[model samples]
Target: MTGARRDSCDVAVIGAGMAGMATALFAAERGLSCIQVGNPGGILFASGLLDLFGVHPVAERRLWRSPYAAIAALAREQSDHPLARIDASSIRTAFEIFVAALGAAGLRYAPLGDRNRSVLTSIGTIKTTFGVPLSMVAGVDALEARPPCLLVDFRGLREFNARQIAESLGHRWPDLRHRRIEFPGTEAAPELYAAHLARALESRQTRERTIALVKPLLGDALAVGFPAVLGLARASEVHAAFEAGLEMPVFEIPTMPTSVPGLRLLGALETAVSARGVRRRHQASVRALAFDREAGTAALDVEGVPGVERVVARAVVLATGRFTGRGLTADRGQVRESILGIPVLQPASREAWHQRDFLDPSGHAVNRAGLAIDDAWRPLDADGKPVWPRLFAVGSILAHQDWMRSKCGSGLAISTAWAAMEQVARQLRGTGAG
Candidate 1:
């Protein structure tokens, strides 16, 4: 550690998942010199929908119309839940800020409201979520109205099958129809990917040709729905052009992951954080982290490069996420925090990790295994004390809640980052550390 290259920042955020990005964005917004470490591989799996709260009492799988109401109920019943612990107003504000930042970065979302909207998935199933991207907002209205609509899919795009979606929902709306068409220049191509198609749509020629092919298939349909592949960076323009050319409300149904929307989301976040002066180490991972009590700073050894480099920060936020993101690692014995070996609150034994049934109503116990944090958002050690004065944990890494089943992943990430950064800023200013 003696001769390694070193840099200092007001805050060093570990991980580049939703939570980590939010932490860095908020930290930079507060004028904190921020350093963000880790790859953003986790974000590529995003569905592009910001879910605040959709299901509560996850055991029942009950869906809620108003996220605020669901959050209130969770607070009353499951007071320890992260989303429940945060006030509705704060959560709302956090979503607003996060969405606005994305909008500023060219990934605009529909105006967020109090009620949750039902979005049609690529598979024809409906999903309840709080915030809908502008490109897909029309699907919300189409779902509510159930008007005569035409669903279109490219012949080579195996991920999206318009016929399948139409048939799946045919019982509910008999008038719904579907068609498959050859993409403008992919007639000879046997298969098509959403990302490539999204980029192609950005070209005027491709957009017009694709629109011409669909215009004839419109028939009696009042609206048109396609897979979420309008455009990559220029989604708004492509969506607007489609609506004008088709002379109808056009919408996008979110396809499965490794999708165009996910890519767009990641790009926008990177843009937002970078615009705010947050240094990125997207190709790096934190190898070792040590806190210097006397210096009131934390030293992080970032790997994934030619040589190790150290980053010193007044405060540190761990947003490494859950198993998939490797924030928590598992073994024959128990789940352990990936970094610093912080105490993880898991089930008694591996036997209790899962129930006999895969689809258990209450969910598997391992989904709730994560670090336990105190009120200040600081991860607790074995003795139930803060691991460090400025060490904080956010997102799915925290225990006592199942974000996936609860359908509050975005809310948990954004709100916790916002709350934790508030404490970080206050502490730094109070101690005159930054």
Candidate 2:
């Protein structure tokens, strides 16, 4: 066996989803050396709208204008929910630092406030979310005002039909109209993707050509809405050019999953953490994790890249995401924690996992199945104690919360990460390891 020394750090964060990224970011910002692992699947599906809380008391589908109020209700109603455990001030500070980092990485957001804003989606539906990218903020105002607006789409872009969107909501918003035009340079392609169009628009010539085509069509349009294809790396510049050329407010409605906004979020988060000096392992998965009880460190075996690599850290943060990210696995009998096989707090049996009616308004019991943590955010074993003193868990993996239904996906991920990182900092530094 090679006697080479292995890489060491203050923290090893598993799962490359938003929660994992936040954990690593928070750790690094607090002066802890961190290494993060996992693929980028989670962030790629994001809509780039950070939802703190929109719906609460899932059974009633109650929507809230102020997320702070929603949390207050959640705390009083569902005290066991992970998000309820995080105080309001810490959550605010967490979002502030998280968004500031993203802005620095070229993804600016409108200043966050207590109230949530409604954004138009491609399906003619409105999504209530807190954090809005500067490029998409105008869409919020346009939707609220329902003024004369032109919804634009390219000819070959599937899954997004401007006319359908306008028709669906036209009765309620009569001033809304839609127009379809051929993209400047994609006449022969027969099909187009948001990411591809976004990259093309980064070129001044292509952006100008596209703007010229839309300029003549903007007859009485006070606002212009396009698919979220402003640009990839230079989205801000491309968005500005469209707004300037059209002499009106230009906004983008986020497309379905695997979109340009999602790509931008993934890239920006990666850049943000990397810039803060956090090490990363992209397209990699952890093979095994073991704790050195005497040394107070964790050892991880990761599989994916060239050779099987090992990582050791003084503390470990399990940000491994839920089902989609494969941080939790389910069988015919139970949903088990993916990496460590820790006891997952799930339904009594598979039979009870879901309601008899698939569309039950309250949602399924299994949706809340995940690791149960203590006050310090450490995942508990069967005996109801932390698996390890230096170990923690964050994000959707925590039991007793349904991020999707609550519309607090980013908040759950970011807030839990912040709250847990605080405990991690204290434990490590309290032991003189920092």
Candidate 3:
């Protein structure tokens, strides 16, 4: 499956993250032969919230428009193309569809609604919400006005800081009872955490032992909150069992750089794409793209494997992500596209790359460094002309937007992928590819 085949697809997408997956799914549903490549499991590094809009007090004053407007514009432009698609009435509606699809696969997203302002984090920060479990009214109601809360950290998870979280919020909610209980699994190597959890789930003794270790901390507590990766994939079952024994409201908080929800999403997407006959090859890094300008085809080289090539369809969707995903490149003083050598929009220097602090709301505004496109989401050359008639760009690859810090990563992927699919479908219809 890695080698070149005489087969043809209506659309071929690169990168398998949210954008790529959504694009492929939309294309396939429209009866297009779609081929998808790359690994999007990097979503695990994201906070599982579907930041459809940045409605939080801290986020509303930004230069961008509401998520609704952004998605509407994408859908409108995409509708001009040939694909069958759905227009989401609002950001919340789009999120509902996303959550529903996830739930059908046994993964659930409990919408907290849009009217809430206070969210309880596992580490104790009162974050605002657009609609995530931590920000739900139920989550807030579970706290019952900042009672004494016990925060637990696996000894080795250095990403979470109990002390910092406590200090940041404790000053405001002085009565917020905070305690850190470190579990023994912290002694294991960082890479071993997931493996250790799998082993624990398979072993009754380990599971019981872990429950026993944390049993003493939950004594008569009003509620309990911990990082999402609490060694539990069936959260409801685990929460039920814990409640049956401890009689406490247990909830999980979203953690960064590989949250549990993000992991679940990747798994769900893999299953969905595979079921639809889409072949997925992981770690099969594409070294170069061979474009037949006359034949209107592209051949991709599978690195480290000789005589292996994938001749994809004439139309390609470059959903490859930003710098971290290797879609964009940065050198001493220049930034450009890595694959296909497309020109990119970049800042003047490293100092202008980001703001000083990671938590600074303004840290991730490198929009100019992304792929430039017209209203149709097609990649534009330096002269602002469409580079390829059939090639479309979506997600983080587009310039002038920061999905992560702006809390719109998932939304951007979904809407832009939808738009790109519509465009491809239209083109295919015009060319009789389908």
Candidate 4:
């Protein structure tokens, strides 16, 4: 490894997904000199929905708590700690601020309430709204307390199975009424759809056209659902305006591989971080970390162009993501810690790794395989001691939780990063590091 004396920042966040970006931003806002180092696109490979909760209706109350409760728990643990320092209220406030910043940067997000019922998508599949199952779409009345509903879809977009969804749910709630409306054009060109709607809205033609199209179908309907793509960030305001003019409750169904809301969030977060002067180094993989306990700092060995370089920082946040992102690894007959060699909490044998089938929705229950961190979010040794005074962990890197199966990836990232930043801030204040 080539040794280089690089400029040291108060915190060096490794990874640039929602978690990493949030940690860096919060750290910088606290007057900490923060540097974000990681691959260019952190979570581009998987779906990007900021799923706060996905507990099935049957397990909701027993398995998981409400969003507010989770945030409160994070706040309680992070307050006065060392890593980045912010509170629960500040966390929510920061999210809103970040949203506004995104809006100003040409991206937007519509806050859907805490209802987790699934809604029918144009493709005919049902997606859980808050945490409700998509299979329950047929029971519309029971799901949303609304009457017969209409499902809308863009003509060009395929892969939706409205027929199957109707068939499955209809068996239980035959009274539910279903209809289809296909928007013009191909699904390939999203910008085209967004632009067409934007111009129509700007010219007042969209409102008129929408009324003409929906008047016959809605004659007297109360609610409707459509593909999440309907609310493209660039045109969300226009879409919302149109929805208001139509006087209908239009809910968006989650789509595949980076749903509409997920895409919007990814774009919004990148824009927000960039505007804050945080230099994001994407596609740069971190290979290892060397810590200097005496200096209360660490140097990250990153692999990319110009060979390897050791980056020094007073603190580091690891948000490399979950299994799909390669943050956690499972090899033949062995499960090893990919980065930092952090001790893992794993099964006794490969046979215990998971159940029989790969597609089993139960997923691998090995939540203990993630990075082991103390209450302060600092990496912990096998002896259960903080490994490095300045090194911190966040997001999927933390062990003791399985975000994918738990349906808490977004919440875990957001809340943990918020807590990590709060702790970092306390550390800075107490030690005068920054």
Candidate 5:
């Protein structure tokens, strides 16, 4: 253990997904020293559009124009839900701060409001989300008016198809047209990826050439849409250039996962948290965690690059997420929390994990299985008491809520993180630790 290093902070965050990132950002903003652990690659699954609450009562598939109204209904119907426990004011403030941090990192968004916007997906389906990136905001308007628009795609980009999108919405949007063009300098390549195309567009010469190719193709079209391959780091500039070169409103439809938008989102978040002075263990994972009840601190064993390093903090926030994040694991018998053997709130038997129908509207029982938390956002032990005074849980790792079906994944992450951090700060102040 001679080569191993030791560090301390006010808070140590586990996981680098949206929830973990939000927690670290909020902690740093509140003058708390923070060290974040786990790989950030999970953020690649994001679509860049943040959903705050679009659906309620998963069984009914009811959509909502206003997320606050949906939350009200959710609180009335399902009081145990983690999201229902948070008030509307706090949720709004959390989103505002989160979005502003992203904007400062160069990823600007359209102004947020009380309503959810309808965004067009790669497969021509409309998704209701609260926060829309500026690059994709035009699609919301185009989708609303059903205007005459041109959709463009590259020849070898397999993930996105402009023709398919037009075909899917043909009946409802008759004037929507589709076109395909060979991306400049990629004609020899048999397959074009979204990330590569996005990087290529960052070069002004390449961006101008691509715009030239599309300008001739846009005839009598009020607006134009493309697969979200606008410049990766300099997306705002590239998007503006396209609208100027084409002399019309331009939009981007989110493609499949591992997309350029996801990359941009991750990069901006890293920038946001780093600027606020949060230390990051980008290549590390927590091997083991122990709490010193009498000392009022938690020790984390982080396994990473050189060797295993120890990180102690006055408070620890678990945003490790669910099955994909390995925060909760299951075997033949039952599901259990991954670290520290915290009791997981799950089905009584493995047989009840899923419903008879695979596509049940209510979702599988297993999807809602996770660690149960007390009123202060701390994970509860078997007896329904907080395991530790400063050990708290946030994000999808909490039970009694299915974020995917409810369309509140981002909401659950950001809002709970904000609420939990408030408690963490207050508790640390009372204990006078760090």
Candidate 6:
């Protein structure tokens, strides 16, 4: 690896989770040159439902229809929570920009509004989330009206059971019906994968055949629901075709990851960032990150290449997620920040991390552990000072908020990315630098 290339940019975004992607998108949108590192495989696990503060008071699991109201409540009760710290206007702008970028990349979402929308899940559960992809939007209306709905599933797809959903909701929506048919070409296959079925549906033959199978079973149903196996590349087109062929409202029920919508999101984000001229190092990660205090710059040692390559930039945004993304590591004694070894704010000891009962209403204290950031979004040292002039932390890597319980994962990522990038832009210009 003698010829390892070194690159420079205005910003080097560490990690490629939702937050990192949002940060890169924002930075690039601002006309700042950005080099984004790390693979964003985690997006593949997303349900494609962008949740923006659906629940508050984790112990009670209180769901909110108005995300703005939930944010206000969170601001009052948990002032330090990341979502609580940002202004509502900034949050709205962030979501608008994020979803707009995705839409440009062919992953259209329902228009953002003041309240959260309820979307159906493959397990027959209703998830309250903010951004619903256009392919799944009709289900939102169908669910609310409780119309004569028909749910469809492929014969070999084991993950989605249309019958299970129909049975579970039997008492409430007796008009709901479910049927299964062999996917056009996967009839002989004993088991089917959603991604494969999705890719296959992109073909006109497959889409038409699948529609033909479901059209006969439409009965008097006003709308039809299917496990989300629409086309991978052209999902909206495929979904629209289904509605036109069946002459009914067609919606998709999100299944567990790795999901078709997740794939679309990942592809759309990549397309959006690439279109904005953001340089990406997919499947690579930041091995080491350091700042040159005198130069007013940060440097990264990127791994997963033939050899370590260097990336120098004016600023860096850490969007590495929590334990799941390996941004925060834990041991028997304590938790540690993985990439930069920044001090993590955590419980007194591992023993105090969890409650005696694993199912305690209150989430474990450990779940809320991560880097502490200044008001400006810079990661703070143990003495509560900025670790680096231009270093910023966003997403689940920030401390004092349990995104999972609060259902603000997407909001926290997108909104904070917008706010932090604003700070980055302002600080860079103030210093007469890019």
Give the better candidate number (1 or 3) by TM-score.
1
Better of 2 and 6 by lDDT: 2
Over 1-434, each residue of candidate 3 has an lDDT whose tens digit, in order, gives 44364446777788888878877777776778877777774576655555564432223434223445544453454333111133554335545655655655555666535443345554556554444542123355654576656555565655555566657777665544445554445454553343245335334455466557667876555666655554434544554554455556655666655556567567666666676666565555667776677877766655422345464686888889888888887877767788887878777777787667756654544643688776666888778887877888887787766665445677677767877777888887888786
Clashing pairs in 1: none
lDDT of 1: 0.91
Please report, in order, the local distance difference test score of every candidate based on alpha carbons.
0.91, 0.92, 0.61, 0.59, 0.93, 0.90
**Best candidate, lDDT-wise?**
5
Clashing pairs in 5: none
Question: In model 6, what lDDT does residue 89 have?
Answer: 92
What TM-score quantifies how close candidate 5 is to the native fold? 0.99
Output the TM-score of candidate 1: 0.98
Q: Give the per-residue lDDT digits (tens) of candidate 1, residues 1-434.
A: 77788899999999999999999999988889999999995689999999888898899999999999999999999888877778877787788999999999999999998999999999889999988999899889988999999999999899999999999999998888999999999989998999999999999999999999999899899889999999999898999999999999999988889988999999999999999999999899999999999989999999866567899999999999988999999999999999899999999999999989999988999998898888889999999999998999999999988888989888889999988888899889987865
Q: Root-mean-square deviation of each candidate, in angstroms?
A: 1.0, 1.1, 5.4, 6.0, 0.9, 1.2
- Lowest summed lDDT across 10 adjacent residues in model 5 is found at 37-46
lDDT of 2 by residue, 124-166 (tens): 9989999999999999999999999999999999968999899
Better of 3 and 4 by lDDT: 3
Per-residue error (Å), model 5, residue 292: 1.1
lDDT score, candidate 2:
0.92
Writing each residue's lDDT as its tens digit, candidate 4 over 1-434 gives 65643556778888887678778777766778777876534455333334554442212322333544543453354332221233446546555554455566665444534434444544444443232212123333334464666655444445444455556667654544555554532335543343243244444464456545655776555655555544444445655654676676655455554444445556666777777777655657778888787877788877775566677877887777656556777777655566876776677787887767766655664653677677788877789887777678887767655565555665566667878887888887777786
* lDDT (C-alpha) at residue 261 in model 2: 92
Mind sharing the TM-score for model 6? 0.98
Q: For residues 179-241, write the lDDT of model 5, one tens digit per residue.
A: 999999998999999999999999999999999899999988999999999989899999999
| TM-score (all chains, Cα) for each model | 0.98, 0.98, 0.77, 0.75, 0.99, 0.98
Query: For model 4, what is the alpha-carbon lDDT of residue 263?
Result: 57
